[model samples]
Target: MIGHVGFTVVVIILKKEDTMRITGISSKPPLLFTPLFPTYFFPTHSDRKDENTWINIHYVEQIKPLKDKKCKVIFVDDQTITVNISAHSMHHQYLNGIYYYYMMDRAARVATFDPDSPIDYTKPQLNIYEALAKYSLFEHK
Candidate 1:
């Protein structure tokens, strides 16, 4: 899939394995969390004064479908991260994904992910797939 973010286009080719049910727990709470969408750091309301200034703004500038590789992203609401991802879009996806996991894990200080269940993005059985669909890394190809 070709991920278009601003003036950049990121071509991501994911094997079926890459898109499989690979799960990971956040070692600690995320350094940043969106005030609006409390489950994720996207679509964050900028007016919220408590949001952390994420190390680099590029980690979530674009939303794309990453299949079933969804992970448990923890949010502690009290701390920030040490390392940051690059702002450039030309970076490789494998490296970027690794860094993404690392940053989230390192920043978290609240809880570990539960491996027994798939993360249900829909709110309380609301089944709002459309609403939760906006949090991807690429659009479905």
Candidate 2:
């Protein structure tokens, strides 16, 4: 399967280990949640604001299927990790069996994904899958 990734990341500082922080606003010293989604730092319309409010969506960079692998004996003496790999796609389980066409082709105007069960969907990886599955146009047989 081939697809493109859209990034909505919040560009922050460049620290050691090549790190990145999103557009969350900082509060306490040794900051708690900075530039994250649903931050009151921006205009947040919640259920408290109205009966039908737009849900705060957490944006992600991409759903990269990791096809890269490297193996090395960093530590010895029974410190071995036999990497059992599998070929798989991403997006939350809730988006199970959603075809790719319905997503990008039709511009995603009318579609709904049944959330993956046993899923908290508190994160992007989970949320995307459930959302994607609503449109089965790109599902695999």
Candidate 3:
């Protein structure tokens, strides 16, 4: 009789597993899920990934178009930093626009590359510091 009671208790414990399963209402839609984060089902931050690396718009001096849908970006601070990027890249799509990247830590939100107005490097009046202050992902917090 004691062995039969232990077997019944095991069956009761196994039935509790159904409570953890998701019903029809709570599951996320297929279209809404993107592979932006490395792990969607299980989030682990053991690997420190560069989430949102940004560039200052005012520093963009020249954008030389290259073959194979690439462009050579000329950004200047004390010196020039040249980066070859894809033309279809979010950065390339919003060229000369006010955008900043993460300096120290990963950004919490997606960096807004799309701006209202196109960036004009010829305009000396454009304030680099102000743009950084306004659009930097860190500033949003």
Residue-pair clashes per prediction, in order, are 9, 18, 1
The candidate maximizing TM-score is 3
**Local distance difference test, candidate 2:** 0.24
TM-score: model 2 vs. ground truth: 0.14
User: What CA RMSD would you report for each candidate?
Assistant: 18.4, 20.0, 19.2
Model 1, span 24-137: residue lDDT tens: 312211222321132222212121335423222334333223324322222344333321223222123323344544333332211222333333434565333322332232
Query: Candidate 3 — which residues are off by over 4 angstroms?
Result: 1-53, 77-84, 88-141
The all-Cα superposition gives candidate 2 an RMSD in Å to the true structure of: 20.0
lDDT winner, 2 or 3: 3
Q: List the residue pairs that clash in candidate 3.
A: 54-101
lDDT of all the models against the reference? 0.28, 0.24, 0.33
lDDT of candidate 3?
0.33
Tens digits of per-residue lDDT for model 2 on 88-130?
2123211221222122323222342322333343665445543
